[model samples]
Target: MPTPDFIRDLRRHVGTAELWIPAVRAVVVRRRADGRVLPSPEVLLVRRSDDGAWTVTAGILEPGEDPADGAIREVQEETALTACPVRVAGVFAHGPVEYTNGDRCRYLDTVFEMETLDGEPRVNDDESIDVGWFPVTALPESLAEDQRMVIGWALDAGAPAQFTEPGTSHTEAAGEPAAQHD
Candidate 1:
């Protein structure tokens, strides 16, 4: 995944205090022909060029861009995978990721469950050092902690759309009953 020039310039000047930004991530999964999701289905993940930690296809939404469209575009831009979001899987306020230069930023992100329409993943841009599909149970050891929970839930066919409240333990919010997706 290539880092846009504007982002590179912004990073150079960003300082220690946390900056909040809206972002989106695509949890793209494969399904069996019968429409049942595969157990331990493969998911698309990308290794960050700077940190090497794996994260799902994601990016900051361009000014006023819709989150679903951003999710689709980011998946394509980052992984060479074309996808369409099925539904909202979850939403979160994550980070305070402190860069080496001490600049920190937090993401208010929406995670969407998407179905791949075409294309195999390859590193499509420089922002990512590598890209591949991995079974949910065998994800890369360097997977980003912020993304792991949602990835797990999305892979589990029985899991429902999760709604998390910021600043609380994820466990405390894990299993409230809710409407199911089709």
Candidate 2:
């Protein structure tokens, strides 16, 4: 999707200045017909149109929107899937992202562990070029480190929501650093 109208309006005033944006990520996992989370579950991922990288469903929250609602909305909009937010998996301050257009922003991200309720995965919007599910043990190499970290938190459902302290990397916050599997 194009930049939201509210952000565009803000951009007109702030130009490319760094903005603190609230965003949400949905780590959607599919369960078995018996309602148990699969012993080896699959996660919904989108291949981003902007960079062709595989990542969890994520987007900026609309002003005044509840973070969980925004996560559900983004999943439906981006992947044509309906998901229920099971829990808040993690929160992080991510990026001083510089877009190709030169817009800069840092995201305060709320990550949710979601259960897929219905619908097939597909590229439902322009933001993504493809959408599909991959087993947690065999995710695509293109997925980013931060995305992988959030996925790990979601899978470790019993663990408390992970948070990062200022100047600490996600690995340090979560403990020992490792690869995507964490």
Candidate 3:
């Protein structure tokens, strides 16, 4: 993904300081039901140009930006799809990556379950090399496990928003356990 100019400028100013930035991720899904609310197996995924990893739409939150609005904006900017966030799925802190440019940072990411309101996904920006809907069951191996966990939670109907402690297993959260598959 192309680094936004604001971030590049911020990196220059911050130098090596360990800053905690706010970020957001959108898990855009559709429901395919037989007799109940069953989320479709497919969710939108983007291939990051930077690492070639397939993941959900996400970006850093700008100063004073609301997380919900940021989530919507990131989805449009990254995937060219209009998103209506149904609810927050998870909040997490991931970080300590030292950029090759010598800047260090961590992101407190809020993940949202969203429905696509309009527009089909295409590469809207250089952040993603490609964008498409993919089956959640057969997600690319390159996708991050944490991202997969968030998607799983988002697909579970009526799930409450979650705050996942960093480094803990996703199966252990602040509510009833997710449905088991047998």
Q: Tens digits of per-residue lDDT for model 2 on 44-100?
A: 998888767788998889999999999999999998888989999999875666676
Runs off by more than 4 Å, candidate 2: 33-39, 169-182
Q: Of the pair 1 and 2, which is ahead by lDDT? A: 2
Model 1 over residues 1-182: C-alpha lDDT tens digits? 34345556776676356667788878888765256766757888787786667778778887788999999998998888889988788887655455655656667778888888888889987788888878877888766455777786566555567766656644335432211110
lDDT values, one for every candidate: 0.71, 0.82, 0.75
Which candidate would rank higher by TM-score, 1 or 2?
2
- Cα error, residue 15 of model 2, in Å, equals 0.7
Model 2 error, position 71 (Å): 0.4
* lDDT (tens digit, per residue) of candidate 3 on 1-182: 45656677877887678777778888998664343655547789888887777788888877789999998999998888898999999887665556666666667778899988888789988777899888777788766667777798788867888877666634344332321100
Error of 2 at 102 (Å): 1.5
Candidate 1: worst-modelled 10 consecutive residues by lDDT = 173-182
31 Cα displacement, candidate 3 (Å): 1.9
lDDT of 3 at 22: 79
For each candidate in turn, the TM-score is 0.77, 0.88, 0.82
